[model samples]
Target: MTVENALAGLAEQGWVAEAEADEAVSRRVGRPARRFRFRAEAGCMLGFDIGLHKVLAIVADLRGQVLGTRRTAVTPALPAEERLAAARRLGHCTLRSAGLTAQDVRGVGVGTTGVVAADGTVTRSDLLPDWTGTDLVTAFTEPFDAPVMAGNDARLAALAEHWRGAAAGTEDVLYIHVGRRISSGLLIGGKVHTGRHGAAGELGVLPSSRWDTAPGRLLAHWADPQTLFAAAGAGEAKALAALEDFADDLAQGVAAMTLTLDPELVAVGGGLSRAGRLITDPLSRRLAELCLFPVPVAASQLGDEAVALGGIRLALNAVERELFDVNG
Candidate 1:
């Protein structure tokens, strides 16, 4: 096609706009090469995470810079519809804070605590009451006015770590998200691995695995892990012992994944990752003892925003594929 036809096509598709020709550029490239530039202000993306304790919404530009975020508490007893409504409110609030509307959103990405199917349905969930089998895509469509994509919260957090956080450069990684519940996400050959049944990294489901019980038992007496870690740091005997037991339990699951995948790095993320060295130091030591070889482990720098950021990445990819004809 001729340059005129090409420019016209791009303009028709709302991808490019004519800009004022600069004198210097016009002199060098002959008439400024028509001065067409990509329309970057076209739209943005919306990313939200619906967790057991809270719902967080983030608005990011196409380039993935977080513009704004809004969070709302989520009680376990709240109905699924109410929880979804809360998510919607937070999403709109984030968009408003970012000085944008739903119409400016290219796509919406949602991460929820559950086994998510490819079509954005929650296959199962126990973290939040009445959350199983939710058609999340449909639920968010009206509120966001865009195509919606959804994934498991832990898995999405792993994706965020891989994309721009802890596991950024690694081709193979094991991400363990430790919070009120224990779950994991796997990245193999630089891609998120969800397994045949979409249940990869669900180590907590194993009856013999301490991943299911250790954290809860530890928290039953202490207000939170941070308190226990503080006590352990201060040389308290009971706290030290409790931390050791928790580390040992966590290490068992890490060792199993290490032996199976031999990932380049193991990333620990989620709400509990904020404990920093308090958790990583002992967990690394125990992991080294359990593994045949020492595996490098790091805490997620993204903290609680990991899943929401991952949702942003997902939304970006979806927008690119649908609007830009680019494949991720």
Candidate 2:
């Protein structure tokens, strides 16, 4: 009865609606039960993933269904105002395609490559020179009169994985996003664990992590990671050896986090995750050797959409908190 009442209340709010009755499968003698369907258009959630090279925007319905999306590539040196304008352009495209206006949006979430403070300010950013200290929340607030939030791109990718990707159902997860720059995010006990400064799993900041020196440090002397990965996938010997060296460096940082968090699994994301076994096999083997115990490693299947999708998840979370009893 309580569940029915809740459903009724949700229906009143236009979140759900009665559907065609299922007459083919009747449980009570000959009478069939009425069906209810999620009205995804009840409210919209806007999500954005603003990275050093790309900006991704998405419009999702209340049921987390992605209605529309837009992705654009940009130079890393682009200024903050230009970047925000690019984001705004992408946001408008997504909303237009989704047949929604800003008024239909209930919440907005943004993910960027930096340490985000509590109020959605980028406290520090190593990639974009002008991104540091940008008031992301304020920037979003002026355009969208909705609940706005911001987070680190890696952390949002972790949230995306835990929500619907590789780490689903896991309580503790360590997500490493390996791109030109390597960063990390964690989920401790089914929740995103952002420390006091929101830089809890920012391993790239540590000089010992070797993320910065990895450009010419692949050991095999072969440049171009894409072609190298392709060659490795084709079973080239030199690329294989270089990959092993890179994996060893990567394992050092991953091992430290694994020993401390003892997470159930480590998910590798970002554009590099497409390498499949060429990367995870070496990473898994290296993790086995360096960690205190066996730590499972899974490559991302979410592609570049992980961070943007995670933004949608975060926006939905806030909407759910305000509209429904999440804890109950």
Write the residue-wise lDDT of candidate 2 on 1-328 in tens digits: 7887888998998888999866576478764666799887778989999988899998988888889989999999889999999998898888989888888888899999989998899999878879999998888877878889899999999999999999998999999988777889999997889999999998767889786666447733655668888889888998888888878888888999999999999999987677777889999998888887898899997889999888899888887777765663
Per-residue accuracy of model 1 over 1-328 as CA lDDT, tens digit each: 4778878987997767998877664276354456688776677888899987889999988788889988989888889999998999898889999899988988899999878888898988967648998999999998778899899988889889999999998999999998878899999998789877678988888867789887787677898777877887898999877777777888888899999999999999977777777778889898788888888889998989999999999888887776557355
Worst 10 residues of 1 by lDDT: 25-34
Best by lDDT: 2
- Candidate 2 lDDT score relative to the true structure: 0.87
The 10 consecutive residues of candidate 2 with the worst lDDT sum are: 214-223
| Cα RMSD for candidates in order | 2.6, 2.7
- In model 1, the runs with Cα more than 4 Å from the true position are 1-11, 17-38, 323-328
Task: Score each candidate by Cα lDDT.
Answer: 0.86, 0.87
